[model samples]
Target: MSDKFTLDKRLAAESVFAAALPLCDVRLMREQRWFWLLLVPRVKGAAEIFDLSAAQRAQSMEEINFAAKGLQRAAPCDKINIGALGNIVRQLHIHIIARIKGDAGWPGPVWGRGARQDLPPAGQAARLTAIQAALAAGVGGDMGPKLSNLLP
Candidate 1:
């Protein structure tokens, strides 16, 4: 297994690069239907959460929570769905999606529900800015020292 961390090709192609947190490299899903964020850990060959060390697990949870709150602030959604189903992309990454009552994949999983509505360049820029700002503000609370310095 490689020790150096590299992003999965599918993920890199499907999402827009965002900021890198202390433990994860944040990516914004290109689909505009839902405000989605992917938290991909920097650990090499980590296919599951258990693949991480105890410190890493704790940091991942904190980063997940931080990302969810930042998404909520940026998108103002009724529900925020979080999951780590590595069925297709066997990388240790968590999905944070903001959902409303009647979104495109409403009442169902966003995965393979319909064609992804790719965000226009302008829309992508706006969303990225909002998300970055919200994250930099540390929406919910203190994100701890490890993460606090990486934002913005």
Candidate 2:
């Protein structure tokens, strides 16, 4: 495994890094209309989850679920949306979004609905702290022994 992992610039500009999981980096999207998180695997040249080995694939799923739980705990919503579309960024990243009934993009996808609004400094700090705490608390446990040996 490569120790040096580079994140795409568009991703970095869109979200804030919240925490480092066993196989991915947990990033919080800047849009305040919805609570969203991105799990970007720390693997080189990975544009999709299939690019990862079987073991890594399992680990990435676990990480994605973990981020979803964390986001749910931080913000309650009617539904949770998870996706991994690399059409623009071309990076292996999973998006976990908390959706509500009357949200800006309700009854539809959040992508390309409108421009994302930036969170204020205080709100950003609060969200970062909450997400960090949820991750540290292990919102969702590891993917068990079968996949244990896969992650370092």
Candidate 3:
């Protein structure tokens, strides 16, 4: 995003899961999984979710739901999970993840599993395109900025 979001160094240290889509207001970075997307809103000096104003909070919720819908279409997940477990990147953000049974670290939390399999370049772009197109056609939003392509 052009809105000058300095990546939280600690959060950046973790592997890039995926490139975010367009519905989210700020940078929605991926955390090295096909099932995971992290949405960090572009509010400066905001460390926690409570730092967001009530209006932004509501808008962010919409953004997150949009993400979930896009994910379900793109990945065909068994279930979708949304939350803000921001122990590292304290920015006011949320995560919308697609969960499936018997995939990777199945039936368990996807926090720390072994070295991650960063999606290959072609695959990443394809998935991003799917998500962006689905969100645009499904919800009528534009991804204002190109997602960072730092995979691998």
Which candidate has the highest lDDT of all? 1
Q: Which residue ranges in model 1 land beyond 4 Å of their true spot?
A: 144-152
Per residue, candidate 3 scores C-alpha lDDT tens digits across 1-152 of 46666657655553243444432432334444645666777677677777878987786776676667767887788887777877856666677677888777777777686766766666656766666555555542333233333211
Better of 2 and 3 by lDDT: 2
Per-model lDDT:
0.88, 0.82, 0.61
Better of 1 and 2 by TM-score: 1
Assess candidate 1 and give its TM-score to the true structure: 0.92
Model 1: clashing residue pairs? none
Give the per-residue lDDT of model 1 (tens digit) for 12-71.
999987788888988999988988999999999899999999999998998898889999
- Clash numbers, per candidate: 0, 0, 7
Question: What are the per-residue Cα lDDT tens digits for candidate 2 across 1-152?
Answer: 65678999999998997877778887888888887888999998999788999999988877788778878888888999999999989988998999999999999999888887887778877888877766666677743332333322
Worst 10 residues of 3 by lDDT: 143-152
Cα distance off (Å), candidate 2, residue 38: 0.6
RMSD each, Å: 1.9, 4.4, 5.4
As a whole number from 0 to 100, the lDDT of residue 136 in candidate 2 is 67
lDDT of 1 at 91: 85
Q: What C-alpha lDDT does candidate 2 achieve relative to the native structure?
A: 0.82
